[model samples]
Target: MTQQPDTLTESLSLALHYAANGWRVFPLLPGSKRPATPNHRAADCDRTDPWCRTGHAGWEQRATNRPDWITRAWSSNPAYGVGIACGPSRLVVVDLDTHKPGTEIPEPWHRFGITTGADVLDHLAGAHGGTITPTYTVRTVSGGTHLYYTAPDTTRRFTNTAGKIGWLIDTRAHGGYVAAPPTQIGSSSYDVTDDRPPAPLPMFLLDLLSRDQRPTPSTPNDDHNAPQRPSSRPYRPAGCGDPVHSTSAYVEAVIAAETAALNAAPDGGRNLALWVMATNVGKLINRGLITEHAALDRVLAAAAGHIAADAYDTYQAEATIRSGFHRAATKPTTSTRSAA
Candidate 1:
């Protein structure tokens, strides 16, 4: 006769198997109470109640009428759904819910599910490009571990099987699960410790984290050294604000046609360069770094050099004409008498 499997034993066995394999496990519960303040409940508290009529309306709007209301309501009303997170060499037990069935597992944890904590750590090391040492400890409610490893960059996010079933790791929603407070009823706490230090995380994940540390671009034309221009003339950058209409090569060719115009008119060529600079300056102004006047001043300053040279030639030609006119005026009466 074939031996029959026990349902409870199967569940426990499964949980243990994952614990050994490096998968994090969290248990679900029906109802539980959490820590409350002395003034936590009052007539005005109904508005904040997750299951109150008004509160439900807000939840419905945001969650699109999904059954996720159960979790939301639980989060507000009480604490339930306690579980542990175990991975290779590490473990953490907390009060929380795993992702609902059918939720997508993050790419990082897709290949591994419900495995021992050790296996999870190994996979993270070999496949995901990080080595996480297991840290085990005991919480008020349960025993668990923490896996610690340096990430190459912080820009990247991770998702895993626990999150696929509505579980959370470290409260960042990497796996769609959120951490619960330990004080809640039905909520279990966990501990974390590492036998060995974890290796650095993958370069890709590290790169993502590094992006967060970068400074934002500065605003345009705030510099005091910007150029000035004639009082009456309006400042306009040459060849600025051309719309990008199409992806076709023909469109690019048309844009390049402006180069010929620039070659024909030296002033226009200078104007084109000024226009490009002004456009970039405008972008900075929008970001709130430079004042509008400051941007204009910079554009005007760049145009000044070209304008000054042109103006000198123009003034010289005008002066010659004026001198000729003065001489003609002195001799003009004799020519008019002969004609009469």
Candidate 2:
């Protein structure tokens, strides 16, 4: 079923939720009136409004657009290129291309915008192991700073977590633009350096640029129709010649255990049968005997026969098994009298 777009109230509610948690919100405003403004404090915006047209439009064009904008805005930039948007009350970093000019980043290189994430920076610093001196600058964005970095191409991927935020400061490169603070004067510019490119721009970023320059993807089933599954097969990992003996062994053990439990019970409750299977799978996962994905596959395959009638039943059964096992294990076992 198709989901409805969030109402303005819903969007505001979410914006408030992030604000309550101390996230900065950046509102994209169009026109030449202001260089930049904090999003949270910025007045309401409309897609049709001329001021709203300044940032990248690529984001709004995406099938699944995020209200935060940063997520979609940075989708086209270098996977390593990082962007920081500061709202009046929050700040967010994203690893996607900034929207085309008039859509996200206001004008200029907006056409050349790129997306970058946190990992990109980590790779560039060699995680502090390489000789590449990672220099950084903090330019004011509305009320926050856009942390910029100058490193070899080595840090071609952007990486950000709770504590990290920065971007690659490319000097001597045309189309180099920085987001200007609302109050700052003059066009965005950075100083050039003599350091060599640390690493080649990541292939993914290069590919994105090349693809952006090409014709848009062909539409089938009409532009208004929901997306159709592509005829091409989905990508899958290739199998090595060697058998996954460990996986086979785990599956066998689970089957044997379930069979034993089923055979031994005088009155086999569905719960008991489920517990047998789930516990076995959980044990394999805990012991590192099987990958989580493999274990899930096995569980789902086994459930096909037992709880297929009600999918929710299978979910509850699994939850019961996990909780029951943990609770039972935590309590001490009582000694029992044996009959001679």
Candidate 3:
């Protein structure tokens, strides 16, 4: 395997290159995705440094295209990886990750013979009657792909999402970051596979994303063809169904609480709140305690109050729920029944 640079020069050079390309760059910790800069909570900011002179500037705010800043930051730490703030860079990077060892591909995706994030993207593209277009691409150390696209210059700002596009596919846009080429983590390095400038995001993909950001009316189905809740049987207590291998009252209670929280979330933060709730609900699905269809139904019901209140659209909620559930499935967490 190719090793990372032993000195500061290589990192500095790459940082400058990214800046020249107008990407807002920041320093990530050596061998990790976390920011290298000290992130103090706003309440704890003493306003002692230039970064906090006016107010606390987090990684996104501090990310810059300034050559001097990039040089100064990287020069001080040779191992610091470069991070590109996607929002300011006006880039949408589709992250296609490989599956972990010994894990089954999740529903819908596995049913369609999908394996990796790339496969999922290709399948999604085919479903939309299109093919993957050439763009600025990178090969991650883990053998995954990152397809970089230029974000449209409109009011719609895409945010970081897990499985919003499809299984194994995540995106970094507004309020997210990506490790730039030449950044090394342990024995591996992120390398550019394609040097081309980013192509504009495809219209079909844009439409899919736009639907996620808009609000919709409160309804049982988010879209015309969204999967409907199981109507063949009445609701059963947790662990009481034939399909469910096990049961946990704790899981059901968590589902209730999380849904309630999502419903009560304030207008400005409802989307994020919804995503979090969906993710937690997905964890239940991961444990096989609740079926995916049942989980989706609960989330949509909770989000109904918000949709009626004009908080967000149904397509957006559906998109978020699917993404969250798929994320949990792909990255299953260790959960104990007692703690559910």
Candidate 4:
């Protein structure tokens, strides 16, 4: 039968396909966040396992990416939407909601002193000796982002919980589930903004989650999809690695050094400081984060303004930039600063 795209059948078809990828799938009510499992009308439905036939709401027990299980669920209720069981998929979703209380439209994230939770997440990951590389980001039609991360290792499921982690933030883990992208609800749809796969949960973030002992998993599932660890090796110039992979904090460090050196350059420390900028930029170049030629060009461009503002000659600035590059190739820093 020809399937109508973007309809319930299409969503169910997707649930089946996700099952093929080892993502445990369940059905949700059309145009709503509620799971479409049996016995959903019961007051204890939220706490019950929707998937287990032995229990009232065995949704969790029944959740599976297996073709047969998905087939049976959708065959009964084709209108049901896709609910991705988070734990077995080895994914934990960090949901950043933008809606104000009792409102439909989204509120500005900055009102809560948060710009992007993912940005705060990156710094937090780096501070705790974790790698911050590309990961999947979901853009909800409600103008919010869902950051996907690896689930912590445990046999049973982690229950869904919200708000204790941060302002407007919630987690979809073990017993909890998330609406897969393209899952429509009313007029909005969950969509993958960043197509990258999920990154592993950082040890630091895991520590914070450990505090919430509520809703722990009841029975351990036989399936565990431990994701393959991807290496995050930025290019090391010669042998030494770059301290900053062109991160915001690193950029700020370079600017501070350059400004101070230019101010005190009257005593001839200008060359040393300029050299520092070159070394800093060289690291960026080696990592393939920025081009070497572009680095020198920016220095020259910035030098033009500094020269005009400080009333310094063009020769001195250009010479200083060149000298730095020379030193970077000849005498790179032996002991690099901490990556944090």
Candidate 5:
């Protein structure tokens, strides 16, 4: 039988394949899942390389779907493996791992004789009155399963988590990476078991994953420690004599409100909505009420669903944000007051 792609040509081909499929991919060190990109301190950067254009970027920020970046990276070291940045790719992957030797299944599951992550996931699904839906799946080198799903469109965010669902089950969303097929460590390789496009994250699973992130009700004493809630009143620009509304709470409220608007913007006006969001945040940046990085990150995340749906790509979204931000930043101070 013909074996899976394993040689240098195959490795580069696999990386390119993932990139062409709209996944933001990065280089993994040869024979390991660790990122191959070298981290640098801001003071050490020359800013001459493509990776250092904005600042010293990490693997997540540098992950790319562009063919040129993919080809250059893989061609430099053909043995390097490929890793998918889950956030940029708009994926939430459930990692179901097999038990190690002598590892006892944790409490709550041990009584039920659960062994692997798959078992825990199945149990969780069964409890929800459903079964695990088949999605694009990968078999890890250690006999684990990575089930890929299209993340939900809601503004709520998710990140990497351990044992969030149940014993031996983990998830990768924003701020996570997964080694892709053909990535090898020692003799074995990651392999694709299910090649279908990712299914939308199951509602039951989404609820379970997002449950812990919800804010809990606070006791009377907690009021002192609780963050200042955003006011229901309309947001007014800073330096307008209402310094009371110029706190970080206001900046956060502005970002939250704009992102919500951006996500709901219809097809014909999504880009315009994106620009408005960026510029609105940019005005905050100009007033030093918010940092540019914070604004850009939230705006990009807000656009992730649209990008995943092919409404626009990352490059387009980023360019629009930067352009709108710069335009607002450079506007005359006198005009800034009434512009908002």
Candidate 6:
């Protein structure tokens, strides 16, 4: 009888295989996304074990195509999960999750109410042309799949996206990382559905991932017919002989509104307020006062001190801010006139 390979051998071999295939590889905690190395930047672990925590600091830069490094990493501990650095590997992965019965997804995300990874593939084929194809696919533990394809350009910075293209359709691209199969999280594993060579992303899909196809913001509302409210009593539009609608003023208004919302927001409502502020800030970001990243970091820092609810996932917060910011950025820079 043939004996099964030890877990260490299996993990090391898999890591080497990925490196040999030109895919940059790194090790993650056995059952978590945490970097296996003690040097992982985000880890709060004490530096007692120099060897374990001593790598790229985190998955972001830990991936490498070097065979020796991969070997050394796995030889130390074979139970680690294999992570693929997306951009460095020249790959992009579309991650589709199975939505529960009553999630907050957009209405009619799936026109046919389609289900399963296979169904999504079929739908994409017709919608995005023959180019909407995957080079390889991996079945996720959540009944979803990570569809991998080579990127047309590795230089473009792509952020992990959520539900932008459609419902349950997220993307992991540049500046992102993914756990490959054989990386078990408890009793489950990310299993490869196919061993076929990954093909380059179809042009249409590449365009979507490139960030150039982002939706433009609509024209600013004149508020010519807005309902009268108590909030309106304190402020009025710039009267005649006043400066043209100032984006800066508009931005300040947005900040004030958001701060009020943040203070009054109930547990679930704070997240919504954060989302709205990010959108408004995006419209005025061109004023040169702040940046998207800096803005978010500042807000999050404030939340750490002021917010009483559980913090949101970093990616989730970033995605929400990005989507809102991008949409608002496309809007007219001219501020609407206020009636005093």
State which candidate has the highest TM-score.
Answer: 3
- Tens-place lDDT per residue, model 4, 1-340, is 1232455457567887778766888888877767776655445555445343454554665678887777777877666778877876877888777645554322222322435445445534442334544678877757778888877667745556675554456888877788877777777788877877678875555654654233322222234563322323221222133333243453433433333333333333344544555665665565555566556654544444334343334466556666666655564543122210
Q: Write the per-residue lDDT of candidate 6 for residues 181-256, one digit (tens) a residue.
A: 8677767778887778888877645543442232221233355574432321122123323343333333433444
Instruction: Give lDDT tens digits, candidate 1, residues 59-163.
Output: 112211122333343344332333332221232222223334677654233433632333333432332223333332223233333334432333444433332
lDDT of candidate 2 over 12-130, digit per residue (tens): 44333333443333323232222223232224444454434774332112211144553333232211112122322122222222223244432112222423323333332321112
TM-score of each: 0.23, 0.22, 0.62, 0.51, 0.59, 0.56
Candidate 2's error at 106, in angstroms? 67
- How should the candidates be ordered by TM-score, best one leading? 3, 5, 6, 4, 1, 2
Instruction: List pairs with backbone clashes in candidate 5.
Output: none
Q: Can you give the lDDT of residue 6 in candidate 1?
A: 28
| CA-lDDT, candidates in order | 0.33, 0.32, 0.73, 0.57, 0.72, 0.59
What lDDT is obtained when candidate 6 is compared to the true structure? 0.59
Give the root-mean-square deviation of each candidate in angstroms: 24.9, 23.8, 13.4, 17.7, 18.6, 15.3
Candidate 2 lDDT score relative to the true structure: 0.32
Off by over 4 Å in 4: 1-4, 7-9, 41-53, 99-116, 126-131, 154-157, 211-340
Sequence-dependent TM-score of model 4: 0.51
lDDT of 2 at 75: 30
Task: Please estimate how well model 1 matches the true structure, expressed as its whole-model Cα lDDT.
Answer: 0.33
Per-residue lDDT tens digits of candidate 3, residues 26-81? 99998888898756777788999688998888899999999988988988888888
Full-model lDDT, candidate 5: 0.72
The number of the candidate with the highest lDDT is 3
